[model samples]
Target: MQDLEIIASAGASFRPGDIPPPPDGGIEAWTQVAMGWIVIFATWGYVNSFGSFQAHYTSTLPQSPFQISWIGSIQVWFTFFGSAFSGRLLDAGFWIPTFLVGAGLQLIGIFMMSLSTSYWHLMITQGVVTGIGGGIIFAPSLALVATYFEKRRGIAIGLVTTGNSLGGTVYPLVVRALLPSIGMPWTARVLGFINLAGFILVAIFMRPRLPPRQTGPIIDWSAFRDTLYVSYVGGLFFFVWSVYYTFYYLASFGQQEVGMSFADSSLITTIINAVGLPTRVLIPVLADRIGPLNTIAPAALCVAIVAYTWVAVHDVAGVYIFSIFYGIASGAFQSLMPTGVASITTRLDTIGSKSHWGSYLGCAVEYTLRGAIGARESFEGWLEGKD
Candidate 1:
């Protein structure tokens, strides 16, 4: 009865073509941006830090690096793929319940991950559980923030995404400091607490600005008909595939190929993420001026070029140099992706569904390819070692 009443009240206030324009700059609107930052920090930030986990798991577990990466892979898979359902829920005004469930699952997954003793246990707790939690909230939060700003969407998104790079930076540093002294379980517990605090802040302040957009297909089939939309989605799929593979393997490459110590290699992950902070903030300012697609095209090319430069980098100094350049380019591309999607989208109500669905497909496919190729390489290495 109360739910129906609430819906009736909302309908009374909002008419089909009478929706007000986004405030673009105000206390309430900006507050949503701040809370969106926290959401990204907790979700993607945690996911981006998987390099730290990948390195540690490889050394301790009986599984190969290929096997250990599935933990991160599966986590990422769920986070992206699950967005298809969660995005539609956001469109329907289920934000509170969705946010609560996502927060609960995240806390549960991380804390349970601390206690996990085997590969399968970690896979279930960290990969599947945490991934689902992050996926459920991540897209909706971004879309909510985007709805609050029209002119400044690029910078707004860029600001929120800095949490991704920063989270990646902080978690690795925490692991480096605590892992040797306290062990993996305690380190994970501390990280879980950090996420708990961030989620609390988000739940208190963040809200959907527009009234519930209750009617729409979950999968906007019409989006597939637009050539530009199809092309944009296809481009992002390949970009994300390459980017995530680098995130997962860069530290391991430093250790295995460059003969760096564990401590030094972990620092490589830190450097890659840390250097991205400035670019994440600065590039979106440009995106807002020239347009997100204009900003993204060059940034993607720069990342691709810098990625290839890794072939020439064989020393400690060279690796650090590569990390800096790659981080800058990649950060620019990532921070602008959603804003780019928003730029192309015409309807405010469908932004959540369209923006998430395309990128989510990319993310899911990236993990699949990573697992398959990594498994093959790992098998060949094992055979050679046996001989």
Candidate 2:
């Protein structure tokens, strides 16, 4: 329940040379860190729970998969796109306003979704509004993790990012259970209330380690001129593309190609997410010891290979194996990305003046869109017997 003002006040006391060493055995420090993780989990949970909503919307609306998909797509797009903007704001020490605006947008979007009666309504409410909201909420979580921990940065990031996996697991089951009883509108309304509560908790507890004035952009445009940064960005593009595609399509693929029942397919998706929860925590720890990119490259390659191989598998066992392996690999890739970015941007503090977090995040989102397009194309091809 600590406020940003309190965090800032504490941070302000430290001079450049007096910056306190990372705290040890301090329950307060741990609590602050935990609160940041909670915020991340809440935000990411909403983000990853899209599959649950996607399934329900597809079933209930039937005429609007395209539109419903937009809800998630836009959420993700804004999540990444908004990061660019929010990152800069966070760097500029507007943590309180950032959190408030994000929480408000998310709450409004959820309420709006509850009233939606058509595809366009969902698109505007869920896609644009909610997407924007989620994006704002997500930015501070990532930025704060970096500010808090240096030695265990990878593990910390991974732990926080695992919230997406946990959300993916829990939200779907909630939707699946509620859909047959309360129906979509009520389910959405209930979800809105839940999001409101979660965001309130975030506003109460999440705080930045650095003072507002000392906090500035960690992102640098000139870094992109470095071949290593370009490679990292390009690699991340493909990595995110593959990650989203697998998440979006794995269930459908199981049902269609592996002959799994709908219940079974849903279970498979849940299992994949569940398995990812641990990987989200573990892989980053490993990356911390070895190297993030070194770890990420292999993990990504494995995902691409295993994902394609899933196309050839049959029955529950094959799909299950694919789901577990692919999930772990994909989860590792997700955990390592930010670390990879951080590793390349080591001079971030010095280069803060020229930082354009928005532009960098915009590039990442562009790649995400490209990935989504590729997934759609693959789905279309599969439907047409091309794959």
Candidate 3:
């Protein structure tokens, strides 16, 4: 009892050398993975379901599809951009406090979104506030889980990432089933309750394993010096730049281009997310053997090929087939991304910091560029129709 008390009290003061190595497997370590699953499910999983919101908002709100997409884009931008700060906090042994603040902001954003009546209101609450909240907690939780396993880190991250698929699948269903019956405010409230419950569990159970890495700059300027790291991050930037295009716009495409009803279009988002479930888990197991880098390179190539095929999809049957293929390809890449980052990071303690830098560069920097591309694509399609 006294020993447990001492460890708990030592938060933020103990040096990295005093801490033990990752146990790699145990009830406690696996429990962190479980908690991480909840975190990912609530954060990225919810983000993945934005297509549902996009389609709904396009109809009910006075915003153009391009304008409505900014809500989701800014949400993603905040989540990715804020990771650098929050992740450093994790390394500094501020995990509990950081998580509490983040979770609180997230819940507030969601509940407030229920009352928002206009585009700017939704942008503030759903896009900025909620994105900030999720950003604070997301990378830290995954970094924490990464610290629990070395050999199995790939599979561990893989399992936790399955939350992305399930959350994406479930949230849309919730919106589809309840939006017409209960209305948008109630639907948003329900999502809030679900996130609130999961966060409570995460707070109670997820404990950080490493003592604070007491001395290091948060930015880790040294990582930029590594040749392999820079190259990998450069590739990741392009992938993140374009990868979300389908997840965010596929449903809108179904309605406008494929001539599907809103309900069926929403299902397109769900199918894309759901089909990812198996690949996200299984591909990491393969990555564990061959190396995360090797596994991810091929997976990324597959995702690109599948995305290019999107231009050819013109009918309802083609849409379904495209969604399934893209979901599997993207899921495999998504599950491996963080694991790949962890593999390259030499020091276990810097995992959070490095992962944050990678994500910030990949997701945040890519967002604005991707948004411009989306706008240009929409305009070109409009002009083609005129011809």
Task: Give the number of the best model, judged by TM-score.
Answer: 3
Q: Is candidate 1 or candidate 3 better by lDDT?
A: 3
Residues 1-387 of candidate 1: C-alpha lDDT, one tens digit per residue: 334323322322323475677888899988998899898888988888888888888788888777788888888889987676787777789899999998899889999999999999999999999999998898889988888887788899999999899888998999999999999999999999999998888888998877788777878889888676777788888787777767777777677667777788888788888999999999999877776767788898999999877777777888789888988888888898888777767666677787766667777787767655665554224323321
Q: Write down the lDDT of every candidate, Cα atoms only.
A: 0.82, 0.64, 0.86
lDDT of 3 by residue, 276-326 (tens): 999999999998777787788899999999988877888999989999999
Q: Using Cα atoms with residue i matched to residue i, what is each candidate's TM-score against the true structure?
A: 0.91, 0.82, 0.92
lDDT per residue for candidate 2 within 1-387, as digits (tens), equals 124223322322324463444442256555555666666666667766676666556556754344356566667766676665676666567788988898798778888888898877887888778777777757666766565665676777787778777777876777667767897778788777776777777778777665554543355556567676676666765555446645655665665555665556666667778888787888888876766766777777877887777656657788788878877877777777666665555333322222224333544565455544444434445434463
> What CA RMSD would you report for each candidate?
7.1, 6.7, 6.7
lDDT-better candidate, 2 vs 3: 3
TM-score of 2: 0.82
Q: How do the candidates rank by TM-score, highest first?
A: 3, 1, 2
- Candidate 1 regions exceeding 4 Å error are 1-16, 376-387
Of 2 and 3, the candidate ranking higher by TM-score: 3
